[model samples]
Target chain A: MSDPCIICVAITGSVPTKADNPAVPVTVEEQIESVHESFEAGATIAHCHVRDDEGRPTSDPERFARLKEGIEKHCPGMIIQFSTGGRSGAGKARGGMLPLRPDMASLSVGSNNFPTRVYENPPDLVDWLAAEMIRHDVKPEIEAFDLSHIFQAAAMVEDGRLKRPLHVQFVMGVKNAMPVDREVFDFYVRTLRRLMPDATWCGAGIGRHQRTLNEWSIAAGGHTRT
Target chain B: MSDPCIICVAITGSVPTKADNPAVPVTVEEQIESVHESFEAGATIAHCHVRDDEGRPTSDPERFARLKEGIEKHCPGMIIQFSTGGRSGAGKARGGMLPLRPDMASLSVGSNNFPTRVYENPPDLVDWLAAEMIRHDVKPEIEAFDLSHIFQAAAMVEDGRLKRPLHVQFVMGVKNAMPVDREVFDFYVRTLRRLMPDATWCGAGIGRHQRTLNEWSIAAGGHTRT
Candidate 1:
């Protein structure tokens, strides 16, 4: 009868456009406001991406600094989750955003098609981020779009880069990622459950799939951020 | 890789109205045509519901007789999946569909909510259907809309109505059912893995969730019928 546990809000995601919903923040002030709004709406974690001064998407660490400080100023103690999926093809610049490492940095486990481009998180790049996360003491959140990505991520763990009590996000129902049906969600979850037995995961899906995957998180007892 | 494991085509589902999409068949001829089209479009399984000679949903085994005859005439040897979820309710008439003894009859473990109705598949009805399916050698596709449904069906197994090699369907993102998200999918599969470790399951999602789930099915080595 009480409220469901673990609500995480994904703020300023890299892909969603202003046309999708006008409320998607594109500026430091908008980002700060959005984070606070999500927090007030019952979110404990805020997944973030940076935008240029012109309100365009950017991977610049300084923009992150302002957003981070702004959130701290307004919504203190809120968990900050930074996106490591810098501009699509600028794979080499991933390390550039590590300046304000914050509490968490997302690392896509494998490459897959996105609507406009491929979300390529190559093994070497994944390794680079894992090593860097360890170096900075930042928690790495494995952002998996499909089952193969989970398998690839597990290999990383077996190879010793990813560590215990692993934090994962099973992304579904995206055009270039995994499909967002319940069976697909169930298969991915079951496969991962067998592979990463004790690991903790949450769900993030695009558009309508988000709500569906969100429900899966609620019923499965997985970590879910509103 | 090769074509996906199973191409399940859902035609003439009970709740979706013709107004939702004109493609939804209303007449028996229209419904049969949809099923044949799904089969021709590379689907191996056709999840079906027989419409009245009028547009309303009906549970008459005679109505299904025409459906069966049409499929055999149009696309022979295709798997036919029937619904125990008759449009009205799960009464003796609904439970009575088993006289036809379909190759596969949907066995919803418990009940949940729909937009305007309560789908009640109480334990007594479930027990009756389980026994019938076993005696007739029919496959009971235990369709679960929530986590509790999964357990409710499991209780049948403990009570000896449902035997090994269970076939479950995790129905996702339906209102008053289990929510559609990755965690719920995982929890259902994981729990089922521990309970009916040897069984097979498919995920059926409404609308946009389908494409996303197909990818998960491929990775998990589970069947994916679109």
Candidate 2:
């Protein structure tokens, strides 16, 4: 039988808030409840981001510890993944929670233009984050914002900065970054497979393109994010 | 009859200096002489970057004006393209020479990592540079360090931020950025042709891979840089 499709649900992202969606969970209790709902809906992985007291994104390890504990207790057998995205924190603080050792973390391997600013993942920062993940035995979901990022990730693996059998996420439809295009999406898949045949990959699309990515990912026999 | 291949010579870049190579032109007179040599060798375009008295890269419009004047005087019928790269300056300073109205100006629509740091080209700065190029009637040669930059340039054209009939340069082999790969080179050509059929493109590889890019570009019927 073909490998079952893994549904990864991002319970709360760094960008969205209660204002954007009333159902966005802010507190640890709410986040646990949200993950439990997604768990019941057959999501095998919980992609998480923590919020501060004022509903702002932060790289606070304390809140992340509490959320991880809650998810572990409430959603049995579901993998927990923390976001090391630039929006949540700057520099080393982005990897502060890696010591807690979630099953996985998101890693951006290169810089690209975001909607408003440059989503900077400098070489040093990317090396530092990959080292932290390795030290804590965390698998990184390589976040490829553009095409070169895939090549960079493969280079990191070859150089021993990253490990074998990588998990990569092809992100698309951001305002100034890679937009959602079917041909490019197919090329991304082909390139990743060509570079690292053992790697597993997923597709993520921002805003309205999310459902479109889900359909494409499923049809292409890759994982999907919701 | 097939169109003759256009050879563009980057007379002096930001990183290299007399220390790295004694032949690198640092002064205005030396740069003009260098362009004259390339023009005699059948190069029709002179890609230029100016240096200060201390031999460091600068966005000084005065220096650019002198270089433009020298090239125009020495290499008749040659296209002069100024480098608006991030290494020479930051923010709006990168575009300070656009008003000098060189035949073409290099524009990077996205950001990527250089050897040691993030090559930051934020959105606002990109928009400002594009607008400045439009205001000065200077044609932009899109410097695509990564795949997304091609898409970004096409989007800018569709949105009227840039003029049509684009000239894009596929830059590879930069450390920490896009590396030289034949598969990627072919994809870059195919993607550009798909997105903008009227567009012309060239291949550029840093350091030792420059000759490789020249050969691949020639074989693929694209322009090349030296």
Candidate 3:
């Protein structure tokens, strides 16, 4: 029998706003409700990003705490994964919520270009975020934007910077970065399995490619994020 | 019959100095002499970087002109390719020498991590450099530090931002970046071939892995740099 697929629901990404999609939950209360609904729909993980009063993305630990509390209250047994992505904050601010000790957190192990700019994840910053995750005993879902990021994650695991039995996410369709291609997607899965045989991976796509990635991930025996 | 190998000689890189290696060319005259020697030793392309009076890397067009003149005079029929790499300069200064219009210039289409910092090549800057190269009639040697770069190059070509018949370099063994792995090197070659069948490619490795990359490139029917 095929392994059971883990479904992660990203209720509010840093880039999307209510203007982009009316149903995108911006407030903490709405986020909790959306995640609760997702959990009832069989989603086990909630990949989260918080917004400020004006609906702008921020790395405020207070906002993350409230959201975490709401999720725990409403959706028991659901995993909470905070985003340490560059879009919400700069430098150390991106990892400010690590001390909250969410069940999991997104970690970009290397830098790459986004649609409009270069996503600046310097080596020292990556090291610091990884160290903070270790201190807080939080699992990192390695965000593999490019192929080298997967290799970097493996290197970190080998050096004990990250624990074994890694969990990585293959992100695709970001302009100026990796686009959604079947061959490249297959190569990513093959490379990850070769490097970390016991590791688990998820596939995520930006904009219109989200459903395509979900289907591909399910067919490939990996996880998918909505 | 097999295609003839094109040997490019990078006489002086931005990071290496006389202190790092006593043999590294520092002055323009020393660089010209080094290129002359390499040209005589069957190197057809000269990958050049200029230094200021105190031996610091700079994007000064005047120094580049002098070096270009010296190479043309001393090494007849040699291809002079200037280094527009980030280590030598920042922002538009990195492409300041493109107006000189050497036979070719290096171009990085995406961003990735360097040893201790981010090698930033923002999308706008990449487009500007590509436009300048087209304006000056200079061919670009697309520097692929990671896998997405090759895809970026192909995208640029498809969008008419970059001309076809591209030449790319597969760089490896850089700390905090892509390391020298045989499987990855092969994948890079395969991906490039699948994306742009008419394009030419070369292999480059930093530090001790340079010779290994040379052998790999030559054995794989691609070019190499020393």
- Residues A147-217, candidate 1: write the lDDT tens digits: 45566667678878888667789877654234565765676677678778877788887767777778888
What's the DockQ for every one of the candidates? 0.02, 0.90, 0.92
Candidate 1 docking: what grade? incorrect
Question: Clash pairs of candidate 2?
Answer: none
TM-score on alpha carbons, each prediction: 0.50, 0.98, 0.98
Specify the poorest-scoring 10-residue window by lDDT in model 2 chain A.
A1-10
lDDT of 3 by residue, B93-194 (tens): 999999999999999999999999999999999999999999999999999999999999999999999998999999999998999999999999999999
For candidate 3, give the lDDT of residue B164. Answer: 88
Q: Return whichever of 1 and 2 wins on TM-score.
A: 2
Q: What's the candidate order when arranged by decreasing DockQ?
A: 3, 2, 1
In model 3, what is the error at residue A207, expressed in angstroms? 1.5
Best by DockQ: 3
Candidates 2 and 3 compared by lDDT, better number: 3
Q: What local lDDT does model 1 show for residue A150?
A: 67
Interface RMSD of 3: 0.4
Docking class of 2: high
How do the candidates score on chain B by TM-score? 0.90, 0.98, 0.98
